[model samples]
Target: MTEGRKMRFAMVCSSNQNRSMEAHTLLKRHGLDVASYGTGAHVKLPGPSLHEPNVYEFGTPYKTMYEELRRKDPDLYKRNGILPMLKRNLAVKNAPQRWQDNAADGIFDVVMTFEERVFDMVIEDMNNREQKLMKAVLIINLEVKDNHEEAAAGAKVALELCKELEATDSWEDTIDDIVAKFEREQERRILYSISFY
Candidate 1:
C-alpha cells in the first residue's frame, strides 16, 4: 500500500476521447483513484473529412461508437487511428463523461486539464458549484495536443505529477513546492489554481 492517503484525481480535456482517456488509463493502471471528464457539449471524433465529424452525446457508449465507426468505414477509421483510440477508451471506461454533468461527483483532490480553454471551463464550473464541503482542490492545466502521440507523452508527465502529489500527506500545505519542483524537473510551465469542493 502507498504511504499517505490516496488523492482522488480527475483528468479533463475537450472531448474526453483522447487526451483525458490516455491519462486516465495510465493513472488507473498505476492503481491511482482517478476519473476522466470532457468539457465539450458532445463527444467528438474525426470523420473522413474535417468538415464532417462524428459526434455523440456524453453518455454514448464507446462500444457503440466503435461498432458504428467500424461499420461505416473500417479502412478509413483504422487508417486515421480512431479505431485503435476507441479500443483503448473502451478498455478504460464505459463511456465519455462530461465535466459539467458530473457536478454531483464526490470531490476530487486534483483536477488536471489538457488545454487552456478546458482549464478555464473547469475552473468556471467549479466556481459555479454550490460548495457544501469546503474542501480544497488544486486545478492544474498542462497543455497537451489532441493527437495520440502527444497525449501519451503528456500522460506520462501527468503520472509523474500525480505520483509526487500522492507522496505528500497534505497537498494543500505543500502544493506550491510540489508544483514548483515539477515545473523545474519537467521543464514545462503549468497553470494552477486552488478551488473548493
Candidate 2:
C-alpha cells in the first residue's frame, strides 16, 4: 500500500502458452509483480488446435521460461514465483505447494482471469468484501476466431474497456462498461480480476 511498492498480481488463464504468456511477459516488462498459471493442471505444451484436429507445435518450455525470466529480472522472479524454485534448489520439500498456497491464501494484490470461464470460477470464490475491494479486468482474446477483422474489433473493445477501467475509480463504472461493451460486441469474453487483500 505504499507508493512505489509493486503490486502482486496473479493471472489465471485457460492455457498458459499463448495469450496469458504474452500478457504476463508484457506486465513483467512494465515492472509489475505478476504470476500466471493455467486453470488445467500440468497442461502439456503444443496444446490442441483451434481450426484443425491437430495439436499446435509452437509452445514454450516452462523451465526455460523460468530461467529466462530470472536472468532478465531477478527481482521480479524473486517476488513472483521464483522463490519456490530457490527453495527447491536448497532441497526443500513441498516447495511448490507452499509457494502456491501462499499465493492463493490472499497473498496476491490482484487476480486476473484471462478467460470468461476462469473468470467465473474466480468470481465464485470471492466473498462480498473482497469483491467490493477487488478489481477485475477482462482481457478478451482476439485469436480465438480465424477472422482478422473480428480479432481487430475484439482487441479494440478490450482496449476501450481497459481505458474505461483505468479512468474510473468506482467498481460500478468498470462493471457497466464491461457489460455494455460485451452486449454490443456479442463476442467471446475473457475476464481477469485483480484483488487487493
lDDT per residue for candidate 1 within 35-71, as digits (tens), equals 9999998988999898999999999999999999999
RMSD of each: 1.5, 11.1
TM-scores for all candidates? 0.97, 0.44
Clashing pairs in 1: none
Best by lDDT: 1
Instruction: Report model 2's TM-score to 2 decimal places.
Output: 0.44
Deviation in Å, model 2, residue 58 alpha carbon: 19
Q: Write the per-residue lDDT of candidate 2 for residues 1-197, one digit (tens) a residue.
A: 11332345555555323334444444555555655555544333221233422122223344444565567666755654443333332231111111123334455544555456766655554432345434543333323331223333443443444334444455344555655665566554544434333
Model 2 spans with C-alpha error above 4 angstroms: 1-9, 30-33, 47-61, 64-110, 127-160, 178-197
Best by TM-score: 1
